[model samples]
Target: MFGDLTGIMGKLKETQKKIEETKKRLDSVLIDESSSDGLLKITITANRQIKAVDIAPSLFEDREQLEDYLVITLNKAIEKATKVNEAELASVAKDGMPNIPGMDMFK
Candidate 1:
């Protein structure tokens, strides 16, 4: 019936709003990570966008060492940011979906 269709459309609009809000929140989330020696630091958003990178002046002495540390630190920072982003999106999906029977198996 038309009434049922209208109700469903309303729910869909509300769910879309929640998803947009979640995306905005995720953009504002910054994940900071540092190298093992604390000589390197990187800041990235939950959406995997690099915001900033800081390296200690002392690291300028060795180019190879600096490159290695940068590579490792960058990879770890990206991985951490990606995992947090995925978890946040997953939470949104879980909240938006209806509680149907046997859904626990998928979760």
Candidate 2:
């Protein structure tokens, strides 16, 4: 039993390392989103860091409209980034998990 526990602990450590690596990798994974009218564009990383924002000249005519577009587009970009981050981290965790009785958390 002690041997099994030791192996499990080792596996958990490895999984944690993989998760950190994945998070670092996610920093480079870009997600692009734009407004419905294509007037605003946003680029963000899977880690939810904004990389760039492109807005059309026409959007500058109305401050409120521009703000709304920014909010909507940024929210969409963040949502996409969140999904990618979660999926990648979950996959690493699930794959690295050691099979133990009643420990089927991934299921």
User: Which pairs clash in the backbone of model 1?
Assistant: none
Off by over 4 Å in 2: none
- lDDT of residue 49 for candidate 1: 89
lDDT tens digits by residue: candidate 1, 54-98: 999999999999999889998998999899988877777666665
What TM-score does candidate 1 reach?
Answer: 0.79
The top-ranked prediction according to TM-score is: 2
Q: Which candidate number would show the highest lDDT if scored against the true structure? A: 2
Q: For model 1, what is the C-alpha lDDT against the true structure?
A: 0.84
RMSD of 1: 2.5
State how far residue 95 of model 2 sits from its true place (Å): 0.3
> Among all windows of ten consecutive residues in candidate 1, which has the lowest summed lDDT?
97-106
- Could you tell me how far off, in angstroms, the CA of residue 38 lies in candidate 2 after the best superposition? 1.2
Candidate 1 stretches with Cα past 4 Å from truth are 1-9, 99-106
